[model samples]
Target: MSTDGASVHFSELVNRNRRTLARLEGSRSLLLRRRDGEDLVLTTASRAEQDRTVVSAATRMLLAMARREPGSMELLLDLLPDAFPWVRFLPETDLHAFAVELVDTMRAADSVGNNASVAQLLVEWQHTAEVHSDPELLAALTTDHGEDYGPVPDPREVA
Candidate 1:
């Protein structure tokens, strides 16, 4: 099966189930695009399980390497900029912190058979880098105002 899966409209699943399944004959997965909701992936259960197993083992190995070798973590930190170009905006200390957090989060998420936390962590750190890239925003955030504005509201409530 091809790893570069085919895309199909969400309605195809209901309107032409056989055609949709046929597309999967040459593809490892199918992307079901939705207009009002998040897109979905259709793949064989075995494939999904295999993917989880591979991710879990890779994350575990990476964590073990970082823990056993003194220079492994440093090597990983050095390579982060190439993997995530936005990380260049972060200071040296923050960059190191991000790398450590990322590996740890990936391992934890893999252990639980979920990648959502890893994705969230990456997005959060990228946003931090974005703020650091903006001099004015960085200055404003770092600056301490003498007066307390008010109590911070809950994000859920604000939303």
Candidate 2:
């Protein structure tokens, strides 16, 4: 029943459900691997709730530390390059901005018990750094094309 780190194929859930359920007894969760879709984590309701609580607390503590101790923000800024090597491509000012936005987004996402936004934010910032790393792309993006475009459409309407 100790199936930590073991992955169960998606079909196993239907064909060998008892075995999979048994595996969850020893471990807090199980990995469900799928061929045509994203993998999933299977865990008890209580365990999932516990994880959400822990993430929320950790994010809150990080934000509090960053605000209470000025040095904590500096420390996070210093560690960002190591955590995200692509961050090095960003200018110093942009790096600081990214860190601040990242921390805020993390806290917000944790509060909602959904980490998708955090992942999205990281991907977006990484792409930004990638763009900045290429001088031609950066210049192209910054260039002002004075040509008049039509009025912007409402996002809600587009949706």
Candidate 3:
């Protein structure tokens, strides 16, 4: 058996399977089926990688919801801590991006008669941009930056 690129020979998976491979040890067995052939690979990521993946998915869903539901963006922003606890674990940049996306989605909805369709389009754009974005860059000009509401202090710091 041999391996190349981001793949491994099927035999490697078989050997690991025989040894009782466990994803809990930072590895996941993925069966790759293709027109040419099939192969199995072991995918691994650190705990931080796993956490970021989970957080990103949840954040996407929350963004989608905020876009889809009228006025829900503000509601989510108002009750972010209570309603979406996973948000607390997100990086400051991610938190900032989420807020920006929610606001953009809302603005995009304003001109369209069918706001739902506009919201759907915004979500699709978001998903597409996620594929192209650098994982470390929090905000890029990927989608519209929406509008500017001027500066404000951190809500927690405000007296």
Candidate 4:
């Protein structure tokens, strides 16, 4: 695949969160689908033989950095050219643009933290952006469409 093109033949995007011992940080997930739309999760970071598969650069970069640099993360642009899935949110990007727009978005997020839609939209955008990179996850995300599975117990109440 051409590394410096406006498009990639195989594309997926995802958004997810990571759960640590006591903290949950923003993260992403992606999955691929066969021609018939059968979900196939692209084996990725920490998995054996992942390099031979087509995984999202975002997922790889995040996992790689997390190993030695706990708080460091490269933006989507920092990882590769615009053809990758995570760059979908960059509506008007150029060669000179900074990678991983999270910074700017974070700044804007801080500015509008009081607005519910602003924060939610940004989270959803980032999530989809991350998920879109893998086919299986993308297929699952698209198929789910925010359905109501059931109600959840209140965490604040003691049984």
Candidate 5:
């Protein structure tokens, strides 16, 4: 076969394989051959999968930044309010924990295939903060461990 004909045949084979794989596995991968004997595998992610990956990466990066730069925690809280309503009311010191919670909530939403649920959860947190003037109450709701971090041993209690 001519070079041009061979190229067209290869292209058609690849496209057909990709569609078949997607139908059978819910994902498609392409194997690329290299001259040096190394092959590369490329895979496709669905929109929801992409969003979940991005959010997880961003949350981890933001948490690292806040830990390394104390000022960044405040900056993150300031910036997140517009997109994440709960951030506006959470104390700067609670940013790390709040961010952790937010990421978990986002992951849960992603699992349920509800992209809009994140926004709804943030708004609900905002309203709860507004209505509850007590700092302890808010902290309980926002922190990793609801009202208690862990059960305090009876001996650790101060008289």
Candidate 6:
């Protein structure tokens, strides 16, 4: 009938279908997707389905900011490779998605100039990432929080 009504219907359909979707690589966002160029489901979750960790409010805010202004995503990406060294804890397959979300959170937190809050979240995120991803996290813990990382292995060692 009306465009608003049509839009509502489309959104509902997308949310419905999305729920049934396996989240592909097992990661999902509260984003709607289209199948055959139409809405397919109604959203049930507030954040992306992730493995190894829960998405925090800070992270969600970051994703929202990225959706609102794609350029903002760059700000989040800049701090990534170094900030979340715990990334070594995550399974290699899941690191990409985790990094993307982690950086997004950083950008959003940074946007409001809440230096204290942002710093806190960054520290926590790093802690979690390091705990879950890095195999050496235990060593660091046992070694009394020393962070003297050595070097990355050659690509061949990754397998």
Q: Which candidate comes out best when scored by lDDT?
A: 1
lDDT of 1 by residue, 22-67 (tens): 9987888998889999888899999899988888888898788778
**Global lDDT for candidate 1?**
0.89
- Candidate 1 clashing pairs, residues 3+ apart or interchain: none
Q: Specify the highest-TM-score model's number.
A: 1
Write down the TM-score of every candidate: 0.86, 0.76, 0.25, 0.24, 0.34, 0.27
Tens digits of per-residue lDDT, candidate 5, 21-123, equal 4543443444544455555444456744775688667655655665677687567566666776655555655555666566566666656766577677666
Off by over 4 Å in 2: 1-4, 144-159
What ranking emerges by lDDT with the best candidate at the front? 1, 2, 5, 3, 6, 4
Candidate 4 similarity to native, TM-score: 0.24
How many clashes show up per model? Answer: 0, 0, 0, 20, 0, 23
lDDT of the candidates, in the order given: 0.89, 0.88, 0.54, 0.42, 0.57, 0.51
TM-score of candidate 6 on Cα atoms, chains taken together: 0.27
Instruction: Please give, for residues 1-159, the per-residue lDDT of candidate 6 as tens digits.
Output: 112122233345446655434442243322344545744433224432322124345555656765667666555454555665555555655455655655555565555634455567556766666666555765665575556578978998798
Q: Worst ten-residue run, lDDT, model 1?
A: 1-10
Q: What is the lDDT of residue 115 in candidate 2?
A: 93
* Best of the two (1, 2) by TM-score: 1
lDDT of 4 by residue, 1-159 (tens): 111112211233222222121121122223333355555443235442343233334334444553445334333345544444455543444212433343344444444433344456546655656665677886886696777979887888857
